[model samples]
Target: MRDFTWHVFTQTGDIEAYLLYKEMHNLGAPELGANAGAEDDEGNVADEE
Candidate 1:
């Protein structure tokens, strides 16, 4: 889906498609994996003192 969005953005120069690609890219980034267990169901990070 990200690749398709990116291809559409590149071929048509569509800002919307580019934004969608960026959003999908960010959502699937590896950085989130490191914090996956840190966040609760509501997405609030659980801090351990």
Candidate 2:
């Protein structure tokens, strides 16, 4: 589901729908980690640059 939503977002550039899908599934903000500041669902810190 996450993959599909991300694919949709990539193909259509619809961030709103992608976020809605993530919210529906209680998904963490993985995309936020692109900046090296977001955490995972388990609260583990991701590697920072």
Candidate 3:
């Protein structure tokens, strides 16, 4: 699923759709293997403790 979305993004260069796809994919598991206060896909940092 990740690979397919990435492939479509690379092939069409549609950043918006790619981002949306990523957001949707991540919705189910927001912190699969990420750390606390981790930066989001857009690189925005969360508040640190």
Candidate 4:
């Protein structure tokens, strides 16, 4: 989907931006595709389909 590394410099050093990012990630945790397994990746779910 969208790249978050770019947000690191998007002037999101505030509560609103933090929450937005947090919520975005929270909703995205379930759609992480196939990179959900293995020790190399964390925060990743699975391609349950």
In terms of TM-score, the best-performing candidate is 1
| Highest lDDT against the true fold, candidate | 1
Candidates in order, TM-scores: namely: 0.55, 0.38, 0.39, 0.35
Which residue pairs clash in candidate 2? Answer: none
Give one clash count per candidate, in the order shown.
Answer: 0, 0, 0, 0
- The better candidate by lDDT, 2 or 4, is 2
Q: How many backbone clashes are present in model 4?
A: 0
RMSD per candidate (Å) reads 8.0, 8.3, 10.0, 8.7
| Whole-model alpha-carbon lDDT for candidate 1 | 0.70
Tens-digit lDDT string for candidate 1 (1-49): 6666777999999999989888988888332333345345445433432
Question: For each candidate, what is the lDDT?
Answer: 0.70, 0.62, 0.62, 0.49
| lDDT score, candidate 4 | 0.49
Of 2 and 3, the candidate ahead on lDDT is 2
Off by over 4 Å in 2: 21-49
For model 2, how does the per-residue alpha-carbon lDDT over 1-49 read when each residue is reduced to its tens digit? 4555677888899988688767956856444334333335335534341
Model 1, runs deviating above 4 Å: 29-49
- By lDDT: ranked, best first: 1, 2, 3, 4
